[model samples]
Target chain A: MPTIFVYVDQFKGAALSASWETMGAAKKLAGEMGANVTALVFGHNVEGIAKESFAYGADSATLCDDPTLADFRAQPYAALLAKVCADGKPDVVLGPNTTRGRDLFGMAAALLGASAVADGIGLALKDGAVHVTRPAYAGKLLSTVVAKSRRPQMITLRPRAFPKPEAGAGASGSVTKVEPAMKEDDIATKVTGYSVEEGRVNLADARIIVSGGRGVGGPDGFAPVRELAATLGGAVGASRAAVDAGWIPYANQVGQTGRTVSPDLYVACGISGAIQHQAGMRTSKLIVAINKDAEAPIFKLARYGIVGDLFKILPALSAEFKKRLGK
Target chain B: MHVVACIKQTPDTAAKVEVKDGHVTWGDAALVVNPWDEYAVEEALRLKEKHEGKATAICMGPESAKEALKTCLAMGCDEAILISDPALKGSDSTATATVLAAAIRKMGDVDIAVFGKQAIDGDTGFTAVAVAATLGWNALTFLSKIESLDPAGKTIVVERSLEEGKQLCSSKLPAAISVVKDINEPRYPSFMGIRKAAKANVPVWSAADIGVEASQVGAAGSAVTWPEIYPLPAREGSVEILEGSPEEIAAKLADGLIAEKVI
Candidate 1:
C-alpha cells in the first residue's frame, strides 16, 4: 500500500492544532487512495508529539528528536525530511501552510527535486494522484493542481480548511526514531531569540473576528470594537486603512496585503469594505456589518447589516451578547 | 554589497479577476509591479545607497514584464534585467526559481537577493526559499528588519515577523531574504527617475542565455500542474439591513446569530 506522510508542526513540545487538521486531511485522502498516513515529527525531545499523532489519525510515525533540530531553521529540518522521503519513498507529503511549514516544504521539495503546492483548501485523488484545490489571485479564483509525474507529491493545507480529527483515547502507533540529517556547526542560520505576543487569540485560528476600519475615527475608536470582540471570545482585526493610519498594528490588519482570515463569524464595525479587504474575509461563514453609512460596501458582503453608528451599536451589541451567551 | 531585487508583474489588487472557458482572466485591468515587490526594490535601493553598491532588479515573465523592471529602475535601481522566453510560459515557483538561480549564477557576485513576502498572482510565496534551496544559499524569509549587515565579515542579522512572534536570526552573506511590508515604506518614482527609466534599456535573457534547458522550465518542468480551474461560487449577496435602536438591532442580530449557530 502507498503511504501519505504528514509533517507534524510543533512549537516547543506541543503540536500546532493545524497539524492535526492536516493529519485529518491526509487520513481522508489516504482512505480514498488506499494509503496509510505516516506522521513525520521533527524537534528536540518531541517523542510525545509522535505518540500523540496516532490519536490524530496517523497509522505510524517517524520521529527525529535532536538538539540540533530544536529551533525551526529550514536547512536541517528540510535535510532530515528529504532523507526520510528518500528512504521511505512515500506517495505524498502534507504539511500545514504556516511560515515554517512553507519554508520546510519548499526546501525539502527542492532537495528532493520535486514541486510543492501551497495553501490547498481541498484535496482529492484522481488517477492515483493527489489533486489540490487552492485559491489563486487572493481567493478570486480556484485552481485544481496536481503533481502528475512527481514522487512524494508535496502539499500544504490552509489552516481551518479541514476538520480536525477526533482524538481517541489510548491510541497507539509504531514509532521509528531517526537521526539528525545535519550537524549544528554545518547550519549557518542561528535563532538568537524570540518575542511572542501574549494573551491575544491568533487571528488565523480564531472562530470569530471583530474588525474595525477607517470609520473607527481614531486609535481610541477601537475600544468598542475590542469590547465586543472580548465579549464574544474572538480576536480583533483591522482594515488596511486603520492599519496604515497606525491605529492598530499590521498584525491585526486583514486584507490582500496583510493576513487572510476565514472565521466562523466576522463582525465588521465602521469598515467600508474594499475589494482588497473582501479578498481576506469573503470566506467567512457569516459577516455582520455595523456602519454609520448604509452605502458602505461592507454591507453588501454581510449577512446582517446595521446602518448606525458602530460606537453606539458595538457597546449595545456586546451587552446583548453577554446577556444571551452568559459570558 | 551588491543587492538584487526580484519582481513580477501582476494585475492591480483592486482588479476583478474571473474565470472564462477554463482560464483565469482579468479583463482590461492595468497590470503593475507586484505591490509587495515595490518594498523589495525600495529595500534594495536603500541597501545599495547605504553600502555604496550596485542594485539590480530582475523579473521572469513575458516582454511586458520589462515594464515591471522599468518600475524598479524608476524607483532608483542601478540596472534591470528580464529573463523571458516563450519556453518559460506557465512556469511554476520551482521552475521560475531554476531559471532565476541560473541568472543569478550568470551575474557571478550577487551578495544578497531580496524578494517580496509573496506574489499577488499565484500567492504561493515559495520562490525565495526555492531559489535559495536551488542555489544552496541561506533562505531568510518574512524579515521585518535587517538589524545589521557586514559585507566585510560576510554576515547579516535580521528580525523575522512570524505569526507566533518576532524571531531574531543571523545568516551569512550570499543569502536570499524575503521582506514583509513592515520593513519600510516604498517610495514613488521621481520625475527624473521616471524619465531615466523610460529610456533605460532592460536586456532580456532567454532560457538558453540563462543556461536552463527547455526540460527544466515552463509547464514541462513544473512539478505542479493546474489541470482544472473554476470560479468560486458566488456569495449570497442579499443582506438584511436591520433598522431599530442600538439595543433592538443588537438583540435582533444576537437572535439571528443564535439561530445560525455562529455565535
Candidate 2:
C-alpha cells in the first residue's frame, strides 16, 4: 500500500489549524490510493499534537523530537524531514501553504528531489494523476498543476481551500521518533524575537469585509469603514486607490497584487472599482457598493448600491445595525 | 564587506502572464527585473555605497534576461553572471534555488546574499530560504531596512517587516536576506548608469559551468509541477441587483443582508 506523509506543525504544543486542513487533503488521497496517512510532528515536546494528529484521521504520526529542533529553522527541519521521507517512502506529502510551510517545502523538495506544487486551492484526481489548482499572477489567474513524478509527491494546500475533517470518536495512532540528519550548525538562523500581527482578523480568512477607497478621501475617512467592520465583527479592507493614496496601510489593500480574499460579504465604500481590485475580490459571495457616482464601474458588479457619500452611508448603516442589535 | 545580490529577470511585475504547455509566455507583456529584486540590487548598492564595498548582481535566467541583467548593471552592479540552460525550463522554486546556490558557489567570495522577498509570479516566498538552507547560511526575510553592517564585527542590523510592524534584528554575516518593496526606493537608472550597464560584459553560465547537472537544474529536477492553468471562478454579484432611490437601495441592501443572515 502507498503511504502519505502530512506535516502538522506545532508551536508551544499547539498545532496550527491549517495543518488539519492538510490532513483532510491527505485523508481523501489515502482513501483513493489505499494509502495510510501519517503525520510528522517536529519541535513538539509532548504527545498532545501526536494524539491530536491521529484524532484528525492520521493513521500514525512519526515524531521527530529533539530539543535542538525547538526553534524553527528551515535547514535542520528540512534535513530532518528529508530523512523521514526517505525512510517512510510516502507516495504523497502535504503541507499548509504558509511562510513556514513555504520554507520547509522548498528545502524538503530540493533535498528529496520531489516535485512540489504550492499554494494549491483544490485537488482533483484524474486518470491516476493528482491535479492541483493554485492561483498565480497574484490571484489574477488560477493554475492547475499535475505532478507526473514518482513516489513522495509534495503539495502545499492553500488555506480554507478544503474542509478539515471532523474529529473522529476516540481516534488514536501509533507514534515513533525518527532520528534526523541535522548538524548543530544546520540550525543557524536564530529566532531572536517574534511579533505576531494583531489587528482586524486576517482579512484573508474573514467572511465579512468592509473596504474603503480613495473616494473616502483620506486615511481619516476610513474610521467609518472601520466602524462598520467592527459593528459586523468583520475585517477592514481597502482598495488600491486607498492603498496607493496612503490612506490605509498596504496590508489592508484588496487588489490583484495584494492578498486575495473570498469573504461572504464585501462592501465597497466610496470607490471606483478597478479591474485589478475586482480581480482580488471578484469571488466574494456578495458585493455591496456605496459610491456617490451612480455610473461608477463598481456599481456594475455591486448587488446593492447606495449612490451617496460613504460618510453618510456608513454611519447610517452602523446606527441601523446597532438599533437592530438592541444596543 | 563583500555583498552579492541575487537577482532574476522576472516578468515585469505589472505584466499579466499565462501558462501555455508548461511555459510562461508573457506575450505582449513587458519584461523587467523583478520589483523586489530591483530593490535587492538597490539595497546592495546602498550598502556598498555606505559601507564602501562591492555589490555584484548575479542573475539566473535565460539569455534574454540580459535585458534585466543590463538594467541591473545600469542600476550600478559591479558584475553580471547569467545562469542559463536549455534544460532549466519550468524550474520550480526548489530547482531554481539549487541552481542559484551552485552558481553563487561557483562565483565565490560571497559573504552576504540578498534577494527580493519573492518573485511576484509565484509569491512562494521560498527560494531565498531554500538557497540559504542549501548553502548553510542564515535567512532573514521581509526586511524593511538594513540599519547597518559591520563586516569587521561580522554582524548586520535590519528591520524585518511583519504584518503589523517591522522587527529589528541583527544577524551574523554570510546570511541570506530577502528585502521587501519598501526597503529603499530603488533608484531610476541614470543615463550614465545605463551606458555603463549596456557596455558591461555579462558572462553566461551553463549548467555544467555552475557544477549542477542539467537534469538537476530545470523542470526535470523540480519536484513540484505546474501542470494546469485556468481562469478563476466567476462570482455572480447578486442577480438580485437593486436599482432604486438611495433610501430604497439601502433598504434593499439591508433586507438582502438580513435575508442572507449577514446582519
What C-alpha lDDT, on a 0 to 100 scale, does residue B127 get in candidate 2?
A: 84
What are the per-residue Cα lDDT tens digits for candidate 1 across A254-279?
98999988899999988899989998
The TM-score of chain B in candidate 2 is 0.91
Q: What is each candidate's DockQ, to 2 decimals?
A: 0.81, 0.44
Provide the TM-score of chain A alone for each candidate, in the order shown. Answer: 0.98, 0.88
Q: What's model 1's TM-score?
A: 0.98
lDDT of 1 by residue, B66-155 (tens): 988998999999999999999999788899999989999999999999999999879998899999999999899999999989988989
Candidate 2: fraction of native contacts reproduced: 0.40
Worst 10 residues of 2 chain A by lDDT: A185-194
- Model 1's chain A TM-score stands at 0.98
Candidate 2: list runs displaced more than 4 Å: A10-13, A44-46, A64-71, A177-186, A197-200, A293-306, A323-327, B16-27, B157-159, B162-170, B237-251, B261-263
- Cα displacement (angstroms), candidate 2, residue B111, comes to 1.7
Q: Tell me, what's the RMSD of every candidate?
A: 1.1, 3.2
**lDDT string, candidate 2, A15-67, tens digits:** 87778989998898888888899998988484678889988999999988777
In Å, candidate 1's interface RMSD is 1.3
